[model samples]
Target chain A: MDIIKKLEWRYAVKKFNADKMLTEEKLEKLKQAFNLTATSYGLQPIKLLVVQNKELQKELVKFSYGQKQVAQASHVLVICIEKQIDQKFIHDYFARVQQIRNTSDEILDPFKGALVESFSKKEREEVRVWATNQAYLALGTLLTVCALEEVDACPMEGFQPTSYDELLGLDKLKLTSVLVLPVGYRSTDDMFATLKKVRRDLNESIIHIP
Target chain B: MDIIKKLEWRYAVKKFNADKMLTEEKLEKLKQAFNLTATSYGLQPIKLLVVQNKELQKELVKFSYGQKQVAQASHVLVICIEKQIDQKFIHDYFARVQQIRNTSDEILDPFKGALVESFSKKEREEVRVWATNQAYLALGTLLTVCALEEVDACPMEGFQPTSYDELLGLDKLKLTSVLVLPVGYRSTDDMFATLKKVRRDLNESIIHIP
Candidate 1:
């Protein structure tokens, strides 16, 4: 299907049919898409937690401000960032780069050293902001992927992160949830499914500079 | 092509073929894709500046930290956010919503009033951050669109936004550049094209909790 058609067919699905579940194959595709999302400096500080347990999803709905889509959807994908983005994290990325690309250390050392030094000097909040930005990129990628796969999804940020971290045990993993996406099949009676998408006109949303 | 395959085929092109250009039809698809990107509250707070002028792109190269790809691509897409996201912006969105959906004012007024009140209380910086996050979503959507269209793209944050704003005279439009993307065909000499993508294994990036 054409991408534009796929995009037009997608929306922030308000209601999901709990009886319809995503196949394992489809969920695997989403995992690959999220991993491939581009991040600044390719540090990839984001991690995705795929929650398929209905009880946990029910528990999460409270933190999500009573958005029942969290519990009704086939799965809730939580995009999280490492609690600390330190020198060791940067080193690990470059080491993986070396192992994968077989690039010489001479070619990698300068950029690696520079990034490690630069990141080490940044404030914790600044790092968190940077990591959160990457999570948004992943969210964006997964949203598109879900649309193409005919998976209904709602990208949400209205949740209380501290509560989610506590319930999901993210703190122990040194991670903090930044974004949540619930994906499944949309309910047939979802009123939002039939509403025309409200978007700005092209001229209002785009500028051409020749 | 499968979405996963298309994603695997995509990489940040280091060198764009200056002689190759995206067809007008393809560019139109990108504009539509950007407009259709999901944003928080569906406010559609982002704008895309499509630059095809070689001279302007050449000028942008310096500000882009000497990244020549900014100058060589068929077009440079600058994603910007409204300088001020005020109550009026919220009202305008609802006005459009009313025009398109013909939903009763009774259904819209309460949500509109709440949004206006909530946004009125936010700091200017807070609103800017929220709007910028939407721009990242558009960026992510466009990245997927570009990949599916067989267009080579480099999603860049290396540029100096203030310089871009001044050069493009964006402040006059009440817009601030938040992200930049260079899109076209990749040059064969771009060695990065052939290297394996460096990504974490699925187990490292995704945690499945059943």
Candidate 2:
């Protein structure tokens, strides 16, 4: 099916059957899809934490405002952003560009110097916020991949972050949870499944030049 | 091709051929996708500004740090978050929910009360930031839709937001630019097209509990 229909076919499933679990290949596709998600400057400052342990999922349920989806899903995916963006990140990005693409310094030097100059001038807070925003881009991409793969998923942000970081031991990595996604097969009786997708009319949402 | 292939086939085009433009139908689908993107508490705290005017796109390129794609793409999609999340916004969201779902206040009243209590306690800046984060989620969803439909897109953030807010007249709406996306077909000569996708290994990026 095409994208719009895939989107129509997907919803934030309220209940999932635990007996059904995603196969390893399907899970790998999701990881690849998220890795390919576009990010500003290609920094890709996000990490995906996949939770399959029933005990850990149950623990996360507490931090997610008692959302049962966290505990019931076959897997809970936590998208986290690096806590800080330092000069090392910018330098490393360019260094990789030179190594992988095998492009000469002439082609890469100017871009590297320019990026470092621009990034260095920004306030530290702005840098962190910018990096976090990129993580959301990754989050959105993963959600659609879940839909396209016909996996029932929910994009959740109602969790307590400080507590989740503690529970997941994210503080050591200098990472913080930005979003939580639960992917699994929906139960046979989820009421939300039968509801219509509510959206504004196209006329109101789109401004055409013609 | 399925979503997986579409994602693998697309890239964040670094440069665009100014002459190529997207068809009206594709643009319409993008608009529909944006409207359907989910948000926190269903607040829908974001608005999109579609710019196809070349002169306007040229101006936006300045705000986006001289990125040629911003001015060359068939259109620029500016996603903005509401400057403040006040009682009015919460009321408006529920009103739309009621209208679209054909539901009664008795069913919605409790949820509405909870939202008011929650948002009221949040500092204005916190609310704004939270709302802005949702905007990024929506942006990511749109990017995936673009890929599924074979529409080339670039998610950008290296911009001067203050200037963009002023130029787009968003200050009056109390909306600030959170993300800017340039959407269209990629240029044949864009060198970034041939590069391999760079990502952390699946084992490194995803933690499996099983």
Candidate 3:
């Protein structure tokens, strides 16, 4: 498939065809895409919340700055971060590494110890920024996957996170929503779907240091 | 190609085959992908530096915490953010939007004005965080592209950016290095290539709200 052509076809859909829904197969690909996104040190500290119920999606509209796409899309995806990246978190990651790679802790301890110590010293806000960056990374990956699969998506960062967290019950789950993506199909009348995408010239965007 | 298989096949290479180089066509695709990456407000406040000079790559190794991949990969990509995202930056973006989409300022002024006003009141640190997040998003899009194209890449965040800016002469360009990715072929001797991928269980990673 011509990737650039597909990339060109995607836009931040301003309006979605509420009646059109993504197929189960299409939704599954997106879930797998997020799960496989590369995170810092492979310490995957992300959770994807898929909200499909119409009422819930409608409720999210206000939190999402009144974006109707939230209620219209086949599914609204909330990308969240772990509340804490403490020592226990590091230990669990190492355990998974050992289980998957069968590497002895003797070989992992130095790195693990360093990570634990590093995280211990980091300010809570610092860790949040770090984790939030990973969430943005996941959004990038999911957006690419959607474009390739011809699924419509509008990624929103203008929403109120506090309201979303409270409404979605993310506080109790230890997941603070950092990014939102509503995916499905674009309404035929959505003028944005047909507009030329605006990007700085690639020549200006990239510098080659030879 | 099965995208999932491609994603599964990719791992962050710890060592790269120094002799192997990416073809010009392959590198161009990457450049295009970054240019097309979805950014917040489509502001495009990021620049990618492609470092291909062997001597320069070797020089970056020290700043990158002695990571050999920096020197060994065919090219080291430095992802950077614009230091000042002020009103002038916002106006230039709208100018591009108008030029490309043939949309009149009459229709764009309110939104553009709000962005200008919004940015005017934001603290410098707040602007930096927003732009840096865009850079992270670019990194994610580039990583996914690398995986699909079978290019081995190692994304590094544990580097000294001040040194990078000095060595790369980025201060003059108003760019602040935020992330790095070394991309090329993985060395056969790199045992990490064969290790099983470690990710949280999909069932646990995804929460469905119906």
Candidate 4:
């Protein structure tokens, strides 16, 4: 299906039947789609955690404000960002860039130097926020993929991130959950399924010049 | 095309043919797509400015470090975020929510109070950063739409925001340019067109549990 049709078919699914599940191949496709998301400076600071265990989902549901969708959905994709971006992280990215692209310092020297210097000058909080921004880019890409694949999803930020990090042992990796998305087939009983989408008028939301 | 295919076909077009331009229908579709982008609390604190005039684009090109794409692309979309999020903005959002959702104060009163209190407790800089975060959401939505429609886009942040806001008279609106995207057809001769997409492996980027 085309994008418009996929978009029209999608909604913030409110409920999911636990019995239904997504195939491994489809889930892998979602991951690939997310990995390909573009970010500022091509620095992908986001990591996705795909959770499908029933016990963990049930535990996460409480942290997510008792949202049933979290527990019942086939999988919950947690989008996380590195807690800090230091000189080592920046150098490591450039090192990978050189290895992957087969380019030497003669070709990548100035850009890498400028990037590292700029990152070093930024406050730790600023670096975290920048990484979080890239996470949202990944979120958008994944959402589009889910829609295209006809998977039901609800993008969420209402969860307790601090507790989530601890519960998932993500703090050890210096990662923090920035967003959660529950994906599955939508239940027929969801009232929100029947409601029309509400959005601002196009003219009011956009300014155009021709 | 499926989203993955569309993404595969897309690239950050570094050069755009100056003479080529987007049609009115295509532009309208893009505007509609952006307006419908979802946001937290359904509060869209971002606005889009679509500029096509060559002279104005030339002025913006300087503000964007003389990036030729800014001036050559058929349109440059300036995503601006509210500089401040005060009680008034929160109240306005809840008011609209009530009107559109037909929600009574009995149901929304606590939410309204909580939202206002949340915004109030946030530091002034935090408010700007939060609003800037919302702008990135809109940027992601627009980029996805561009890819879906086969429109070449370059998501850019390499620009002077303060000067762009001043030149665009955005301060009066309490808005500041957070991100800029140049959208148009790509130049066939661009060197980046044929390069394979570079991304980390799924095993490295995503962790799966089943």
Candidate 5:
């Protein structure tokens, strides 16, 4: 379908045109898209940090292993996970579910209690891994949304998370960055933009069990 | 902009209509979409297993913790990762890159060698975690494509992966399933089809640093 065409046109843009800024309306669409992304158990434990200040973007570049795209792009999107995914998080999630669907506690309590109990027993690292996975899902969704909008984006995981957390004051916010995406328009001089995408053949990537 | 509408129209379907099946042409689109999903470092370490056999689907339901959607969907899509992601995998990836772009070995070797050396030094579990992250990215893309195509899908992580690997003989292929997606039409009687989605407010989920 046309989706494939959009996907084909999308690449991990390396050089962004910093002069071109995304309009407020387009940014609103991205916000809605991030909010709409489906998360594990609908917990939605991830947050998107939109960096528009050029000074802060420049500071982020050092933590990003000198990847200038973080500073050069119109906006840098940092995906972060909740620092503490405790019982309160679970309870708050179920409260929203109950409020939105108007479902009875009788119907929600069993599932809600089970999740709260199960997550409470898990180790911190285990919970972090689970939350991190959800962030990746959101990243994937945002990448597609950018593609369809004809917005150039570079999905990155090469940054120093601890440094990012320190610089962005994410620790105080109780969030840790897991993924970063630089979104804007591609520069005319970006040679990598014209390079053919390297992908496995369809037969190699998909196995049919009919 | 239209992508947001499709994203809104989509939901994690609870029950699928068993009588309706995805057409071959539509399935092909999904195959292309999966192959085209961007992965970390362009390694594309994930694989898609498309199971259409009714008997196998029935067997898979038990492993899926009695999730009837597993058996009821027209096809079950299992996202898997390579059992061993080492230097060989990285080398093969760069080979394909060179072949596709007709780039000189001089241009590809430095990046290729660095990736091979870095991944080879990582622990097995670390590599598995990295590969699994890529699988989630692919799952995210697949969910969006399904939405845009108006094909109902339930992106699932609630299944037993060990059982799936044993049943599907994925061990023989040196692969492990990370995520499962049941794609089909939603059943009319599914109560969840009408429920409003519970999501965090846009302001709460997004931090704007201007």
Candidate 6:
């Protein structure tokens, strides 16, 4: 299908086929898509956790407010933000940019210096909020990719993040979960798959200044 | 090109071909894509301002930290959040849902009531923050769609919101700009277009639990 038709086919799957599993090939594409997502200042402060262990998935359903898709989907994707985005994070990002671009420090320093200075003035909460927004960006990218790839996914935010962090040991890894997506095949019995997608009319939601 | 290659070809464009413009057909697809984007609880408290007027675009460049893409692109898409999302907003969403899906209030009222209760307890800033995250989701969706459609776009956050709100009269419309995207063809003379996309290795960014 073309991109638009594929997008039309996409919805938040309510019932994932428990027997279905995403191939390693599909998993790899998702990882690449997540890595390729555009982030603020290209800082890339997010990490993705691909959980396929059934027992762990079952445990997470409770943290997800009893959403069984967490347990039934072939894989649970967790999008996370760095616990702290300090000067070191900024320095390291520039290092990656230089390594990839072969750019000189003279050109990179002014840009990096500005970012470092800007981040320094931000409180931790400010930085976290900023990073969380980037996490949402990643979520948006994955949802679209999943649709194009014909992967059924339910993008979720109703989960308890503190419970997830403690259960997944994300705190030790200096990460915090902000979004959860269950990916697999939609069950034939899932009625939501056939339901009409509700949306505001384009004219109602968009303003044109000509 | 396939979607992956298309994604690899994407970048935050710097300079746009000032004379080039997005055709109505392409703009319509983008509008549909924006409307089709999966918002939180389907309460799309987001408005897309499609600015195609050249003089207005040029005048707003200063507010965007002097970024010229704001002036040179075909359309400057201002993604804004509703200034307030109250119980009435929740009620209106369910009404739309009922209109589209013919779903009865017997099924929708509990969900609507929960949302109303949730928002009633939140401070205006909190609701604004929630709505702002949805805007980022829209940004991510648009970036991916633009890439797939081979449209050049620059997603930006450096613009002064207060300035944009005042200049664009967004506040009068009960909206606040959260993100800016300039969409058009990239300039042949622009150097940033050729820069290799920088990203961390998948191993460094993703964790897999089997």
- What 10-residue stretch in candidate 3 chain A is worst by lDDT? A1-10
Q: Write the per-residue lDDT of candidate 3 for residues B145-195, one digit (tens) a residue.
A: 898899999999989999999999999999999999999999999999999
Model 2 interface CAPRI class: medium
Candidate 3 yields a Cα-based lDDT of 0.92
Give the alpha carbon lDDT tens digit for every residue of B1-210 in model 6: 567787899999988999999999888878888888888988999999999988999999999999999999999999999997987888899998999999998999888888899889999888888999999998888899999999999999899999999999987899999999999999998999999999998898998877
**Model 1, span A1-210: residue lDDT tens:** 788889999999899999999999999999999999888988899999999999999999999999999999999999999997888899999999999999999999999989988998999988888888888888889999999999999999899999999999999899999999999999999999999999999999999999
Worst 10 residues of 2 chain B by lDDT: B200-209
For DockQ, candidate 1 versus 5, the one ahead is 5
RMSD of 4: 2.0
Residue-level error in angstroms, candidate 3, position B112: 1.1
Write candidate 4's Cα lDDT for A1-210 as tens digits: 556667667778889878899998788778877887888787778889999899999999889998989999999999999876777877777777777777779878899889989988988887888888888777767776787788889989889999888888898887899999999988888888876665666676777654
lDDT of 5 by residue, B94-140 (tens): 88998899999998889988888898789999999999999999988
Clashing pairs in 3: none
> In candidate 3, what are the lDDT values of residues A61-109, reduced to their tens digit?
9888789999999899999999978889999999999998899978999
Where does candidate 5 stray beyond 4 Å?
Answer: none
lDDT by residue (tens digit), candidate 1, B37-151: 9999999888999999999999999999999999999999999999978888899999999999999999999999999998989999888888888888888899988988999
In the order shown, the candidates' DockQ scores are 0.87, 0.57, 0.89, 0.58, 0.88, 0.84
Reference-based TM-score of each model: 0.99, 0.92, 0.99, 0.93, 0.99, 0.98
Ranking by DockQ: 3, 5, 1, 6, 4, 2
RMSD of each: 0.7, 2.3, 0.8, 2.0, 1.0, 1.0
Backbone-clash count (model 1): 0
What TM-score quantifies how close candidate 5 is to the native fold? 0.99
Those runs of model 4 whose alpha carbons end farther than 4 Å from true positions after fitting are: none
Tens digit of per-residue lDDT, candidate 6, span A41-83: 9999999999999999999999999999999999999999999
Distance from true location, Cα of A79 in model 4, Å: 0.7
